[model samples]
Target chain A: MSKPVSKFYLGVDIGSLTTKVVMVDEESRIIARATGRTGFSGREVASRLAASLLIELQLSEKDVAATVATGYGRVTFPADREMSEITCQARGIYQLFNKAETVIDIGGQDSKVIKVLPGGKVSDFTMNDKCAAGTGRFLEVMAGALEVDVKELGGLAEEASDSCSISSICTVFAESEVISHIAAGRTKPDIVAGVCNSVAARVAALTARTGLAPDVVFTGGVARNKGVVNALAAQLGTRLLIPDEPEITAALGAALFARDIAPKNKPCV
Target chain B: MAEQRRYRPLASTRQLEKTMTRYYALTRYHRLWGRPLRRPLAWVTSGAPVELLLAFNIHPVYPENYGAICGTRKVSAKLCKVAEAAGYSQDLCSYARSHIGSIMRPDLAPMGGLPRPDLLVACNNICGTVLKWYEALARIFNVPLLVLDTPYLPGEVTGHAVGYVHEQLKEMAADLEKITGRRFDARGLEKRLLLSKETISLWREIREFCRAEPSPLNAPDLFIHMAPIVVLRGTKQSLKYYRQLRDEVKHRVDQGLGAVENEKIRLVWDNIAIWYRLFAFFKDFSQRGACFVTDTYSGGWAVELSPGDPLESLASTYTEIFLNRSLEFRARQMIDLIKDFNAHGFVMHSNRSCKPYSLVQEVIRRQVMRETGVPGLMVEADMADSRVFANEPVKNRVQAFIETLEA
Candidate 1:
């Protein structure tokens, strides 16, 4: 007799910078996960990783009950259902911390503050996607100007005695300000701290527009940066709860939706 | 590949094009026929008392409408640059900026720019920007400027406010007589007022047709068809055009055909349109089976003429415009619209060009949501300048807002 097959839900998140896939079981437990650079072909990256995860779990495509896609490139991925990152992120955070009232997600190209209401729903949200000043791309560009890996920015800023000030909210203008600081013999750590502080300030203003609440949760690629996390907490004057593997929150949220909301026999790629 | 969605073009689109084309041609070639007819061309604001001008044998031209044309042609950015270079602040109303730019460079303007005006008329009822905007135009064209100072109504229209506007209208008539070299016949004014009232009533009825299930018209329909009501008011042609539009929309309602295919969710719109992406932006919502059934911007012309003396009626009607009212009044207006249209939600365009309309919108949004129990989404973009439009962000918000409603 063949062993009884286990059913699973699959979620793929295709962001501007990276793609993440998460598999969850019937009870919403994480079964397996994968991540890859999005590059120019988000669809290819997402599909390849999803298939690889299925293979690793010793299962065929039929074992997956439902598939959901979420992110900036959500529409590009073939799935049974597509949802915006805002709804997905709010769901993911509410699952982990039921008391979470506000979520600040700073992604690769955009930053958003979502007001999480009771019942794991989004009450209101605001985003700064018109420009890249306060997003992960902003830090990456400033990191390149300082000749340092973006990963080292948090630790370097922690060691700085004094932080500089970046007045411009534009990425290009901020880059020139950093160069001039370098030319004036300012230390890289101070400049890095300043960049982080400026990002925190920009995000704080955006959060104020949505009316921040207690038990704020931070999730996204930028949330992994310790310096930015510390600065944002200080600026907002509230403690932020960072989830384990913050980058997968949105994907995990999508998988949770597939597990809880997607109807049986729903067609998926 | 995903199936591509297409919107059905309205049957009256061809007629609209023909009517607008002939109207612009007449305005453009006015020198040829206007002199023979002895009709002086007067550039007027959208909210100016155009019926009064028509009674004085003056041909009215709207720079605001021409600004919309430039926006549709995607040349507003270049025209705005010319005005900016000429020392107008970039922060000024983009419509005003683009109009000034066209005046400075007619070679770069659409249809060789608007015809030169023998006089300029402006009303402060819409926004204080028009007063400054027309002042700049009067300086450039070396023409007489007539200003109508309608005090903003913080609440109900006060007797003092009507009196102030009435005094100004009497002075404006004398000024119009001097500029056009024609008398302001009270009987002619009464006739024009009656015509304006009938046209506005027709527009109101056309908008009310959207109350039907699976609305017969959408925001773009109202936006496009309102041109004649704005420029050609007090004329028989305006009434004729609306009579045709009203019947076609009524037919659509009778057939139960919606503006959007398979309409699922109905929405109400606030603020000026993002003219640069009007069709494309609405297509995104329409593809999702969400149709904007009505809007506050275009409905400004649908108010009934008050029951009083003709000039007194114009005073109260024009002074109590939606933009000129207090936030509480605007909020109530939106609530009434949402309830009347049976809208599931509302979208607010936080327009960067118009300050008085865009500012205090957040407060109003919260109020409307609290009262209606339906969600509201605010998208920030310039109405004319496409530069401020962030496509990805807007799409994500719209998609998410719709998802909430679906859930």
Candidate 2:
């Protein structure tokens, strides 16, 4: 029998919007997780985040069995294992919720919908990276337009009974549409809710094409927005199972993948 | 009223015919006639004749265009025989093959062609493929070559960027004047700018017509729609042709017909056309009724000028296009297109030949999907150059993606 690895594993998700890091022991139990806004220096941000997490956990780099990097800036991070977000998320979601058939990750700058198969493999997926309409930036723009903070937009979305409709899917035009809606006497909460609905609708539209298998797990920064999550759930016609910390799914997936690879470092049974 | 009356057809059939002929001709090729200056022509020591050489006082020559001309004219096949003997692949960019082919028969002008260029300007903005492309031609023709180095703008166009590009345009103008031994005429330049804007306006109108409930044309067919830009940019014929095309599209939209007979899916095309497998790639979409309602090209032409400052706006517009901007800017553009066209999803060409365009595609694909909740697929292929196009792989991936979307 192979000796058990006393090693910790690290997973870093260096995304355009935010960089996420997660650490786990050999058994795949999450030890620590770090979420930080990524600016111009993604590598530096990811490295610092991982280093701090290691220190917080009182673990050394040598104790790490394997490291995996995933997300848009996955390759940018200097990690031992560079798996695509697809592989990382697939493994990560499978570990968290075994029943998750489709995984939708809406990041700060981009969004992805992965069709997960039986064994935690990505059967198919679709991504939209060309626009800022359904991204965090879109929310920020809408927030600024509404004269509210982005963090507050979600709660604001929950407050309204009668929501305003924003037809322009273009971020710039949507901002204008929001302003016009306000001018047309739509309540701020309703407009915010409409924006959330619009964003969820866009994602739902893309995911609908992929043929979502229910027990869908929604992860990513945008998933933190209760309004968006609910809106998405409503649109997909499925109850979304939000992980305890949805944002760390990619990093968690990366860490899980690190564990899967860690066993390879040991002798076969 | 007088202006309308003056332009009206006369009673005589001859007058009517001339009027109709002029109207149609102007509607087709009128953009070619407004030559701002009667420029002196320079003879190339060796190469095809420049199309605008006789018309413009400035010497006109494009190595790549000349290379394409050779291949289209059928002389490249003979030259490929020589290059093949010297161990060049037949599957390289057709322009490169044709240019190298031209070199083998230096004495012969390949039956009919332009004289060799006195000067060659190669810009790496469109694709890095052209840097080496023109290097081959520079070696072959032994001409003075100027390489315009455009740093890849990663996100948005700032004021500093507009200034930098404007400076570069000025430098290009200086180089042209020095090569032609002529003075730079602002008025002359203004006319060209006006013509270009007119052409762009017509193109914008045609593209805008595609936003109709049933868009008038599919994305692949846009390759044909875009002919005037490449063949006659900065020419009156291009302007006239665009007007004609715009008229045709307007008529079609008015009649309420889908651009393609049965457009199954409305898609936004990202990246440049895969020129090598252009027909086949487009056919794959057209056969499926997946109409490309809009594209990055139309977005590029979506430039409008503030009144009374056309030249400045042209300079600004050219520099600020999504092509000239950062990946973030391009992402925004893509999002804008998908939303504007009411596109169901996007098919981003992860063009192998154009790295600048394709490198951030995966990221953009992810971001666009995330933010807009729009579905996107990246089809790996090359822009223009055929050698890098992996047909089967691209076809399979596209087919799978389409099926996934349809599903």
Candidate 3:
């Protein structure tokens, strides 16, 4: 008799700027993944990524048992189910670390601090309100002003002997501050470090409002910035558990949910 | 953006608009009729003793209501900026800021701003901000400002607190007598108080009708219909309006009509309504089968009048409002609402303009969740300023909350 073919579940996170897809088998192990820019058409990007991921995994569309979509652009992407990034992030981090008490997710346009209770449920949460001052967009803007790639910001900041202080709490005003710093002949690395510090400070305030707890997990595109990671660690006064692929954490969580919600299992409402 | 479709507006909205337009017209053209009718216009806070002012035959105009009108007209941001330019901090209450801005530039205001007040009545039962706001108005308008300070009740209303408020009411009566050149008539005051009590009872009944399955009224309906209750509290007009509203709501309940099409999740709202996006904001929830059956903001006027001396009762009734109490009291009040309304969850607006109402909300959320075992969602936005609303984040949070409830 032939062995049974393994069933795979798909999860897609169509964020404002990026679309991520992850495929996990019945055992909840990620088997394939893909990421792409979500431009103005998140549904198109999600479908293209999903097709590419299926090809890379040598699977047909029918091979996927279930699919779940998450993030800001979730509603645009058709899936078997839709979930919010808050729940997906909490679920993903808890699955990876098994002890994640707090999660500080800094996305492209927003930041959120979620308190994770036992069993991967969100106990409480708070998001950055109506501003992009402490998010990945902030870093991208500062990088553009400093004439450096966003990925280079962390390394450059790490090389700085001292960091400048960014006093403005607003993104637009802070960009002006950066321009003034550049005009005043401040070191690029120092200015970059200052930007990182400001982002960390803003995120720390958000986490504090949600009552930050131990075993903090950092996720999202901003988690890749080493300078921000270091500054956030210092501000929070604790180490962070960053997933191997920070950007795919929410997608992985969605896949996990899909696995549990496949045809044989009772469906999630 | 997709083509925005207007939801079905309340039937009472036409009547409300007509009544309010006539009222405003009367105030605008008061000079033509004031001398013969012997009516004076006084600007009163939402929590002020409007019944007493009515007894003195003074036309009571509510700045807060006009602030809401400005909010609905979507001019609050511009008005608020004007106030900010005039040196008021942006952190101050947006309603106060917008109202002040309207006064400074009446040409830019709706209806050339509320007609000038002969007297300003400020009550601190709602928030201390009113005292400062009315004081600023008094300074600018140069009118007498009567402050009725209602001490914050950490627990139940105390005799000392009631006594203090009673003394102020007496002094206010004397002041009204001096302004109107008439003796303070206890009979008139009692009659007005009785009418106010009946009006409050009718308002309460209208809100209670929301407890019906597939609630007869939504948050905005309650908000719109409560206008008369706020501005015409001691009049036959308010009682008449609420009676019509109560019957309409009762008929909706009988016919098994819901505020939202398929009302699956009933929610209790905390804090003030986002007046700028009232219909659009609630559309997102209603589309998902979630309905806001009741809210703490408009329900502030639904309390039963304490049985005692008229002034003493007014003192206790106004001072014991939900906003004037401690966080514990507010939490319990929310819990009772959730239970009484049979709500599946609650949504709290962490409003930026109203600090007293927004602050301590996290604590209250925790307490209510612990007591009720139902989830609570917090959306941080300004009540009046659309600039402070983050659409995607709020959508994500609300969607996630509804998902949790569904699970």
| TM-scores, chain A, per candidate | 0.95, 0.93, 0.96
Residue runs of model 2 more than 4 Å from their true location after superposition: A1-269, B1-56, B59-115, B128-132, B147-151, B154-156, B298-315, B384-387
Judging by DockQ against the true structure, name the best candidate: 1
Worst 10 residues of 3 chain B by lDDT: B3-12
The residue-by-residue lDDT of candidate 1 on B355-402, one tens digit each, is 999998989988998899888999988888877788988888998898
Per-residue C-alpha lDDT of model 1 across residues A55-111, encoded as one tens digit per residue: 888777877888899998899998989999888888888888899999999888989
Question: Model 2 chain A, poorest ten-residue lDDT window?
Answer: A260-269
Instruction: Give the per-residue lDDT of model 3 (tens digit) for B1-407.
Output: 99544344568777788877878888899888876887888999999988788889999899888888888888888899899999999999888988999998888888988888988999998888998999899999888999999999999889999999999999999999998877888788889888888988888888888999889888878877888888888888878777877788788888988877778899999998899988878887887888889999998988888878888888888888888899889999999999999999999999999988999998899889889988898999888877788777888888878777765
Candidate 3 or 2, higher TM-score = 3
Q: Roughly what TM-score does model 3 have, to 2 decimal places? A: 0.89
RMSD of each: 2.8, 21.5, 3.9
Clashing pairs in 1: none
For model 1 the local lDDT of residue B20 reads: 84
Instruction: In angstroms, give how far residue A132 of model 3 lies from its true place.
Output: 1.9
Candidate 3 segments whose C-alpha is farther than 4 A from its true place: A1-8, A39-44, A59-67, A78-81, A117-119, A156-167, A173-194, A213-215, A234-239, A257-269, B1-18, B85-87, B104-108, B251-257
For model 2 chain B, give the 10-residue run with minimal summed lDDT: B3-12
Number of backbone-clashing residue pairs for each candidate, in the order shown: 0, 37, 0
Error of 3 at A178 (Å): 5.3
Stronger candidate by lDDT (2 vs 3): 3
- Colliding residue pairs in candidate 3: none
